[model samples]
Target: MTETPETAETPFDRAAEFDRQVRTLVDRGYPSLAGVGPEAFAAAVAPLRDRATATTGPCDIDGGRIPFLLVVARGAAPIEETMPRTTLHRGRLPGFVDRSFEPGSLERFVVPEEIGLPDGDIYLLLDVERGEEFCGVVPGEAMKTVAERKRTPLTIEEGVALVTHFPEVLAKNKCFSLGGSRCGDRRVPALWISKRAPKLGWCWEGNPHTWLGMASAGGRSAG
Candidate 1:
């Protein structure tokens, strides 16, 4: 049978490819997560599946496409907004907002509204030297919750508490085991060999940066 163009598999679909590896991690454990393969994430994000934004191009981290959504929530504001203090960095992964250097430092972003995103939207987010930050979304409000529109970045502890309280978002990973790069301390989530999944090792601090590093989704999926 011929696969529809919409359903056809491309050679380098990164998100689908990573999802496939997650299934493999499950297969390896055969019903025991052992702290890896964050499959519960799938169920948590289910409410927004119909609301996911479509893209024909690959994700910046993987250079391949996946079903991850770009939120454009309803009643979203129409102005292009950005965090005035946010710093940019070049790391192996995409979607990272370079700010936090220590475990207690606060990283920040404007909600979809300020960015003209549709209401009630969610998307994949990545970070270096830290656990992945996908749950940064606030369900019913913009992330910046001040009348003046200024947010106090959540302390790492505070942020992790809210996100991982569900048992689905194990974002305690600071990736500090992997030392910082000469450029900076950027790392990604990782899986270990002893069956403790998502152990968080390997640094992205090297020259000749490849988009796919051990911390990146593509490199992890390919591994």
Candidate 2:
């Protein structure tokens, strides 16, 4: 009998998944959106590709939780670039922001200093959780629970990256909130399946939604 590859336990092939992510970003023109050349952007993420292959186990899909090694483009890149590129429906449908929000308004949403994100133009988010367990809970309460767990809430850019790389994670009745980024106000940004497509929208902090959960991550790594 031959020894089995550990990836057999995973829902998808890790190497293939990683390749798809990279190819999607390159194909979707994410490099230019981030003000970088396509080849340079691909080179920058080459290390992550190497790292993914070297890792063992099931690639963090245990019990239906999808853990992502997110390659986030922030700082130099405007939110507008990443937001509209988030795709679903097998990359056919493009993402859109709620009509209520005007272009460039997302700049007000800032990551809290407490999150201690790594400094970089590009960075890595490790073991990102979609926070499915927090559905039906208000953002305020869910945030408290997240703090108790010692996990960091995900920013808008990070949330976009999750769906961009792994659109399958954004399932029906399983949308998530981006409480990690906020202005000095009551609004919380979120991504959900809206009008048969992926949407970047906002909800009140005090509100609860049975369909939406808070997204979070183990931490950030400097790329």
List TM-score per model, in order. 0.23, 0.85
Worst 10 residues of 1 by lDDT: 214-223
Candidate 2 lDDT, tens digit per residue, 1-223? 0112236453445567666777877877878776788889878777676555544334443222444555665675566777678777465677887876666778788888788677666666766788888899999899989989888888988888887776777888888999999888999999999766789898899999999999887777763
Q: What would the per-residue lDDT of candidate 1 be over residues 1-223, giving only the tens digit for each residue?
A: 1111133353344345334433432333322322223465344344433322322333322211222322111122111111111111221121222332344222222222322222232233222112222123221121223212332222222122111211122222311111111122333222211122222223232321222122111110000
Choose the strongest candidate by TM-score. Answer: 2
**Candidate 2: residue 13 lDDT (0-100):** 56
- For all candidates in order, the CA lDDT equals 0.24, 0.75
Worst 10 residues of 2 by lDDT: 1-10
